[model samples]
Target: MAKIAYILLCHKGPEAIIGQAEMLTAAGDYIAIHFDGRAKPEDFQQIKAALADNPNVTFARKRIKCGWGEWSLVQATLLAVEAAVQAFPRATHFYMLSGDCAAIKSARYAHDFLDAEDVDYIESFDYFDSDWIKTGMKEERLIYRHFFNERKHKWLFDTSFHLQQRFGLKRDIPHDIQVQIGSQWWCLRRRTVEWILDFTRKRRDVMRFFRTTWIPDETFFQTVVRHLVPDSEIRTRTLTFLMFTEYGMPQTFYNDHYDLLLGQDFLFARKISPEAIELKQRLGALYSNDKAEFKISNEGTSLFKFLTGRGRIGRRFASRFWETESTLGRQRELMIVICKKWHVAKRLLEQIRQVTNVPAIEYLFNEEHTDLPDLGGIQTSLGKRTRHRRALMRMLFDYYETDQMIVCMDPSALDLLQDFASDRSTTRMLEVQCVFSDEYLIGHAMRVGLAGEQTSAETLERLLPTIRGDMTFESDKIRDAEFEHHYIINEARDAEENAAPLSNFLDISHDKARQIAQSDHLFAD
Candidate 1:
């Protein structure tokens, strides 16, 4: 068995962090935690005392005053990494995590997964090569120096930075070093961690250069690690899931995020708050039960990996439209439109009907008089919209009795749905939509058709061409859109108003109901 070390960077959520530590603890496995220096002494002491009895747990002797998008964040992480390395000399791999993160898999599973790999699990992309430069800080993050966390002479720093930018005076990136950026969380092998420490020691100038850069934590380790390893040795994916808002705020996970969390291939998920006590308890119980039943077997391991599209094999296993009682009137309107655009509607119906091997395909409508054209294998039920939706979902959960249910209405998500169906290693409930484009015609259709929003006939006409194009269900575009949509939905649901609906309808939360309501339709005239 290989020893694993976890370096947890924490400021809050002490109980959750402690739970995480306890879950990952085993003989030869160790944990090192560094509480933010800004945190109260009592808070740190409380977390420390909780793990005092555990011999495998240790705390960093040096804690940096960490702040978001500051050098301190990287400093604190390095401190924890160094402490863990010193404390657990035999550790084969180190997993970097946050205070809010929880392990979704068992320690044995994680160990087996890593033991089968000779590569580092770190998400890295060249700074200039990725969309990060376009979507992220761009020149502001790299060209000018930032003193964002500096309290003293803050005005002076801002003035100086502005003057530098105004005069085209910029800090020169090291000529020999290629800059890379990625998600800050990573799982690195022992040699890689040691190399990073040694690299920093010998390259003090590099360290000093990044000190003034924005969010250096996301880039520093990535640039260093990629530079040291061969391309084949690097796997550009983190084994953790982090949800960020459009404004770049980290999302707090709630009970509703449970299904999505379990569906992902990641070993851990982050930003879980203390308020999610129920979720925390559920996760604890889940990992405990999984760990108990876990046994390393060779049957179908390779095939399972191929089917799921994940690098490591673990255990071999195993939504609502509309709100309103005037659904009949709404259905009449939709039917008239469907009749008008019969070609597109026919294609969509055929595409859905052709989808085979699914346990059952059911459509629930609130209107008793809905005369929707019947498609084979799709069961339709009529009742009050919300009531029908809830009952149907419950029935589907009971009938399938497994996690591999893919519930989607749009034909655009067909490719993604097929992917889910092929992967039997895990159970997932997939809700397909044009999550990439808020202005996508299908999104507008969903808003008006599903959410009961009012729209003009002219808008519907303009949306026809786009809907026809979307019916093809371009796999690449759908995948990208789904990723972006998940990001926004995760963020929005963290807010109070959105939280309620998110809890009630977990899959619908990703559509960002409020944002969709307010968004301008491109086809609207």
Candidate 2:
């Protein structure tokens, strides 16, 4: 089986691209580059020449105009996949890589790992509820579909609803899809790629809808993958082998900690300055500068190209999401603890502290109940007032206000939430719930509407489900005790004065947290 590395690019890096080509050379993988037509002529030409030594490099003829939520990137990827297949007819697997990405493993090892897994990597799952197809289109496609043609977006709407009802999806659909998949790029066996291509060609409706949606890159891949192979035995995420530039890298939660760990693991320190000739080398990584020879395992006999279920001939493969839900729920619980106990809310806060500047201690408790203690010499409330509820009720509104709020209910769910927000509102919300992870507390919080904060007539509708989801028939004692505790907290004149019910002051989840987060309003006056 042959392995091909598909790298997608737009205008930014030339040296980074060259460095990646060298890494692909080391991995003995064929390289296909798709420039988005936005790159400077000099940089584009330089990249073309750098890979001139490798007979495997294939550049696409169609240069898409790159942008987020648009189909340009996705189309570019499809073009690259098409070219790689034609140029390297013997290639068995196609790995989608970004120009700034560096392979994490040697070519030989990556190939062997795919061989051993005996599965193809692709995203194939439904993301919304059935009713979502109707009026839901506006909400689901709310983010980025500007590049899509109006006529083409219809299919995305249709496909989304179909996937939900027909594909056995759980209730509630979250805002972001990438977080749901864990990784944006993946390795796909030739068979799977071919299947996707064939399905796209065959399903006129799917193709048509993909043509005009917002964020078609994400919607297209997800919808089609789910429709065609709902039960494929594929590992949802592979290690991100490519290194990304500062701009290209996806935002991270524990970025500082992760960067330190990843740098050590890869033997690199920081991102290379613009003056550097190569990325890994510029970053002080062990890298090669000479012209390199590239070779991939032959299409039919190599270890990397081995297909999963060698003898099976069906497309009904279940996705990895089902098995991952519980694990993700538990993991989010830990992150909540970290945020509350460790005093690190986000990468920015961590970095500022690392750089020797003192951030106000209140930012650490930004996620906690707004009624909590003072920081240093000041007492403040950063929450905003809503028409129906107080600041206490505003933060949970995303989940509580709308019945449509998607519960990721998976490890990546929290990640998805984080990606949707600019800062760490989602993390704080998760931590707030972490206190309620216990059956008694969960039931207690739900029943008392988080200690009478759910009392507003406008908020009562939203609190009902939480009450039902947590409380069961057998636990009257815990229920009664919780009720009494909530009564004491709310009834005491100090309840509003010292209404901070969150056990962990660091894990705050007051209303208006999202509003505060949006305005970067961490420090209260």
Clashes per candidate (backbone, < 3 Å): 3, 26
Top candidate, metric TM-score: 1
lDDT of each model, Cα atoms only? 0.59, 0.42
Off by over 4 Å in 1: 26-28, 133-136, 150-157, 245-251, 290-525
lDDT of candidate 1 over 17-107, digit per residue (tens): 7777887774347899998885557778888899999988999889787655689889888888889888888899999987668766666
What's the lDDT of the predicted structure labeled candidate 2? 0.42
For each candidate, give its TM-score against the true structure: 0.54, 0.43
Q: Give candidate 2's error at residue 388 in angstroms.
A: 31
Model 1, residue 159: what's the lDDT? Answer: 79
